[model samples]
Target: MVIAIGFEGSANKLGIGIVDTKTNTILSNCRRTYVTPPGEGFLPRETAQHHKSKVLEVLKEALAEAKLSQDDIDVICYTKGPGMGGPLQVVAIVARTLALLWNKPIVGVNHCIGHIEMGRNVTKCENPTVLYVSGGNTQVIAYSRQRYRIFGETIDIAVGNCLDRFARVLKLSNDPSPGYNIEQMAKKGTKLMSIPYCVKGMDVSLSGILSYIESRAPGWLDQGECTPEDLCFSLQETVFAMLVETTERAMAHTGSNEVLIVGGVGCNLRLQEMMRLMCDERGATLYATDERYCIDNGAMIAVAGALEFETGQSTKLEDTFVTQRYRTDEVFISWRT
Candidate 1:
């Protein structure tokens, strides 16, 4: 059995996880999130600092939880791209250091593929349409020609970024998360205001919607035209509908009957409910995980990296660098047929 440990700090969350590739089982998954105060968003510099400070602690906790040592770990994995540069660097440096110290082979993984692999493994879905929604990414993908082809994606800001910026406008708490707080308030909302729905072809646009909402938020609140809850509800309904629309289009095009949602925003219950409804309508199965696997975590990286390693893929020490713009479709799928 090959045991792989993964390091992930692509964004605000820093996580370490150990997985056994033979059994497709996660031995340990640990994480720490950097949360800003209400009305504030996390800057890349501050987020990177947070990861640097907490990386060792989280790594130790994961190893202890897994009851494993360097001797037992056969491979080490780290997210290499498609994230904030500083945060990615912090994790990459740590991963490199660990690999050198332990004298083990290392694999650099793509963050999005990490999520896709973990989602498929956890849900046991053979070939499903993937809706990967996160703070920095939003895309509808499917496997084709040994690559995860992107059928649809946001042309402007990502859906999670839109929600987060909107939360800042409302001065929502970032304690647990801005998206989570918005979801709670939306549940209490009784009215749905008219919000713009922008889905162009296979791509969706969310920046304009956020801008439109921001411009009218003060006026709507001051005039008592709508409550915060109502606005949140409207925003969720509109954006999620756009997402569902594009996802369905991809499903139709691919003729896929399974849908798997991944990433931080995938933790939203409302999003899941909408996707579930769409799946039910089309007789497709909807597969998703809770915060553990949904939000960014180390296990996903370990799982993906393990797959890469098993397929005879390993990053040379010279190529262990991180990038901020690694596209999911750029990675060659050596393990997948």
Candidate 2:
């Protein structure tokens, strides 16, 4: 049994996963979320602090669940960049220390690529165009030349970020994550309220819609005109439509017949339905993974790391560093070799 351990502390979430390479099974996975104060902007230092404090607990929990120990692990995998520098650094330190202590190989995986690779592994999709929507990202991606290329992305704020900000504006519960609350609200919504939908070329503009929703809050509340559920449903419909459109366009442009949805937002059933409908109409297949592999987790990282290690892609202590904002195109495909 080839056991690989993965650590992800890229955003406000800390994750650890253990995978068995031989069976391609996730033995254990755990996630701990850090809260951001209401009305406060994202602070990298605060995020890092949260990771520093809770990562150990999460790691221990994952190991216990997997019924394994540090001695049983073959390699350590950590997210290298395209995330908050502070949080990334915390995980990087843990990964490096463990690798050195165990004299094992350490692999640094790209956060976005981890999402994509996990999508591929779980869905078993062959060369599909991926729609990656998360708190920090919204992109249409395709893998080529050993790297995942960004075919289209948000021109402004990410889709998940937009939803989070909107959720905050409505005084939605921040606990258990705002996205989950929005999803619950959306289910109760029956009315269709119009929201702005803007997509320019391959990129999208979510900031504008966020602003529009905020401005109309007073009016919507005063008249008892729109229930929170209605608002949630409309928001999901508009934002998800834009995502589906962009993904379809990418699929068309690339002449790819398959679509795979990944990332945190990909767990939304409405979004999945939209993409599935689009693919069905186009005579293509639509693949989506469950929450276990869809959200940022360690199992995906372990699986990704095992693949990278097999291809001789290892990170050096001197070279490993956190990047608050790394581009997807910056990763060179070392796995294909």
Candidate 3:
């Protein structure tokens, strides 16, 4: 069996996973998250430290759970880019060291492509218009001519980043995640307060909406004009609407009947419901994976990297570098026909 090991430390979470490509099965997935205090965001230096401290333990767990020895690993893969520089560098260094120590070939997988490939593998959705939403990236993608083409994207801050900032404003708990807390609060919201909906043709702008909400949220709560629940509710409705609308448009443009949502924010039930409604209206199918696959994890990197390796793709030690601004469409989708 062709076994691949992947390392991921793009953001706050550090994950390692083993995948058996010949059977399309995940052998093991292990992770550790660097969660900050309420109203605080994780800094790159500290996050990288967390990864450095936990990386070995996580790797050991992954190997033990997979019941595999180092000799059984056919290749090593690491997330190459589209993530925080410090965290990405930590993972790259670990992956590089392991690759050399084990005398195995190494591959650098794009972070966005990892999410897309994992979503497809878990959901079994073929050729769907993908709506990838997360803290660092946002885009509507569809495959064509061996490329995941970007049809729409954020012109400003990402939707998840907007939510995270708002969560800080409200001093929400970061135990699980800021966005999950927002979704829970939104469920209790009875009123839909006015929030700006900024959609620029195919692209969406979220910074303005976040600014408007952040400016009014304090006054709204102090004056009893609205509750935190209401604010969360209004924010979700407005932003998710923009996402759904753009995804629908992409579906129409691509003539695709399938819609797949990936990335952290895509785990929100409200967003899934909104997209499902839209898909129903258009007689299309909505495909989504739960938190396990939606959240950043090493399994995704393994899956994507294994695909590239099986198709004769490998990155030399000198070429294994990371970038924070890797775009979704930049990589050539070699495995896809």
Candidate 4:
């Protein structure tokens, strides 16, 4: 059995997970998210500090839960980017330190692949049109030619960031997550107000929607024209509909019968419902994992890294650098071959 430990803290949440590849079991997974006050988002610097302070404690907890010592682990894995620079570095540095200390080979896994692999593993979907959405990324991906090809994606700000910023505008609580609060508030909405529906083919642009909503919100509330629930409900309806539309397009174009949604935003129940309806209409299946696997967690990184490690993909100590612009298609998927 191949046992690997994964460290993931690309953004606000710091997670540690242990996976056993032989049985496809996530032995241990623990996460701690750094939330900012209302009307604010987590900063890259302080978020890094939070990870640095808590990384060791989380790792210890995971190891205990997994009932494994450092000697039982075969590999060390860390998310190698397309995330906040500061937060990414802390995880990478910790991974590097642990790799050296334990004398384990380190594998740098793509954050996007982490989500995709975990989703596929949990859902038992062999091949599907993947809609990956998160704070930093939004992409419609399909595995073709041994690559997770990007068919469509956000051109500007990510969908989750747009939601978080809108939540800030509404002064929603960020205790658990801004998106969750927005989703809850949206449930209270009676009317679905109008919002700009901008879908340039499969690619989406959320920044414009965010800006327009921000501009009109104060005025609308002052005029007693709309409630915060209305705005939240409308925003969710519009954006999620856009996402479902693009995902369905990808499924149709690829002739894929299964649609897998991954990333932090994948935990939204309303989004899941919308996607499910679209899939049912098309006679395709919608596959998604629960928040434990859907939200940014170490299990994803461990699973993806374990696959790469089996194929002899190991990152040298000097090559363990993280970057904010690593595209999903850059990493060659050798396991597929």
Can you write out model 1's per-residue Cα lDDT over 1-337, one digit (the tens) per residue? 5899999999999999999977877999999999999999888899999999999999889999999988999999999999999999999999999999999999999999999999998999999999999999999999999999999999989999999999999999998999999999999998889879999999999999999999999999999999999999999999999999999999999999999999999999999999999999999999999999999999999999999999899999999999999999999999988
Best by lDDT: 1
Report the C-alpha lDDT of model 2 over 164-278, residue by residue, as the tens digit: 8888877777676788779989999999898888999888999999999889977997899989889989999999999999999999899999998889989988898988899
Candidate 2 residue 198 Cα shift, in angstroms, is 0.7
- TM-score for each predicted model, relative to the true structure: 0.99, 0.94, 0.99, 0.99
Cα deviation of 272, candidate 2, in Å = 0.7
lDDT of 4 at 169: 94
Ten-residue stretch with the least lDDT total in model 2: 34-43
Candidate with better TM-score, 2 vs 4: 4
Counted clashes in each candidate structure:
0, 0, 0, 0
Clashing pairs in 3: none
Worst 10 residues of 4 by lDDT: 189-198
Q: Which portions of model 3 show Cα errors greater than 4 Å?
A: none
Question: What are the C-alpha RMSDs, in order, of all predicted structures?
Answer: 0.7, 1.8, 0.6, 0.8
lDDT of each: 0.95, 0.86, 0.94, 0.93
**Which candidate, 2 or 3, has the higher TM-score?**
3
TM-score, predicted candidate 4 vs. hidden true structure: 0.99
lDDT of 3 by residue, 272-329 (tens): 9999999999999999999888999999999999999998989989999998988879
Candidate 2: where is the Cα deviation over 4 Å?
36-42
Global local distance difference test of model 1: 0.95
